[model samples]
Target: MHTRDPHGCCYLLYSAVVPESRPAIPRPMERKILIEAGHRCAIPTCRATPVEIAHIDPWAKVLEHRPENLIALCPTCHTRYDRHEIDRQSMLAYKRQLQQLQNDSGHPTQPLIKSPYMISTLVIVDEHGIQVPNPFKLSEGSHNFECMATYVDGSSASYDPYWTCPLLDRRGKFILWAVLGRQRRSSVAISASMKHERYTELACWVFPPDGSERPPFNPCSAIGFDYSYFDSPTDE
Candidate 1:
């Protein structure tokens, strides 16, 4: 999975699987796709320039291979989509507007339309739930951990070690956690020796604070770090 970069354009390199099957996109293909998508924001009445390819369906649900599944969008729209912030009304409006534009412009009938990129830079928090710079710059790579156990309360057993919290995707604010796999060899060793059993890696997500409608970015989430070149948090 690829998170929208600060500029809203994310190259699906590390996010790609079976490179031989799809291969990396060529420059011409990328340019053509961007140009055809209107080179503006896809959101209704939003005129921001598009910077990234926003997936109509959440990447977590389906790996979209066709350009039809992707739309060139600004970082703002991309972030909102990533956070699942677009409400039903806004979604419906976007669909209607895009349809009208396509019919008027004689464009091919497809689900996604291109637009200028516009994204918002977010301040990420740390394990203590304190705001911090984008730690992604400091981390080496992305990691994915699976649930090895479950709880009587029905909560899954997956836990993140970097932030001392469990995995949770609260709203759009992604709970940024460190991939405490091989990177945290010393920490993992200490935790393992203390428990004397094979333990999983440490990870974290977001949790909505009391009375706060929105889930604040975990203290360890991207805050001050720059996203000039970065990948999404995922199990690769």
Candidate 2:
């Protein structure tokens, strides 16, 4: 039997069925929708991945699983939409933006420069907002080292780096490591632990290859790290 839903989509009602004879449900078409959306939340300014599929029209009203009726949304946005904090019109606009992004082919790219050799000074800040000079120093051929840096509530802004360095002390306690690269900006990932009961911050300053001048540390410029250089098993 077929019944028209409120949004004019027809849904089949199974009046009688054997428990083991039911057809397999179709794969969630929303998975394709999320892929077309670059695996990010459809909402602008929210780059969170692994989003949930939300219906533009409430599923109860539409009873449709079509791509045009579905959108990728982060858990927070999904909850807000379900709770009526975001209205249908706004959701539709975000969906349109995603569609445009998928269709656009003329997006400009950032210019790349030769990788410069960088000099790094590691700074460790304690939970009390005190800046302490890192005792460990970067040596020739020592591209990676581990140390801890703590941050108080107001000490630094939240940022994620491209490469994450996991640090551990002699006793196996979690510590923070700030690794610097030759790029103009650095990337960091912040993880919180209940046992440690403190926030950690990673900061870096990228110097020019010629050592002509020193750049000051700016906490506001840190951003998410891009790891496109790494080769994966999927690569041909």
For residues 48-126, could you state the per-residue lDDT of candidate 1 as single tens digits? 7746766576555564445545566678767876777655344444544444455645566443322111111112233
TM-score per candidate, in order? 0.30, 0.35
Q: Identify the candidate with maximal TM-score.
A: 2
For model 2, how does the per-residue alpha-carbon lDDT over 1-236 read when each residue is reduced to its tens digit? 89998999999998764344433224667567878677877765454666887788876566556788888888887887888766777677666655655664687432211111111223433334344343322222212222222222112322222232334567877543323333443323243322332223334433332344422221121122222222223445
Best by lDDT: 2
Give the Cα error of residue 82 in candidate 1, in Å. 0.6
Worst 10 residues of 1 by lDDT: 114-123
**Model 1 regions more than 4 Å off:** 1-33, 88-96, 104-236
lDDT of 2: 0.47
C-alpha lDDT values of all predictions: 0.40, 0.47
In model 1, the Cα lDDT at residue 53 comes to 62
Question: What is the number of backbone collisions in each predicted candidate, taken in the order shown?
Answer: 36, 4
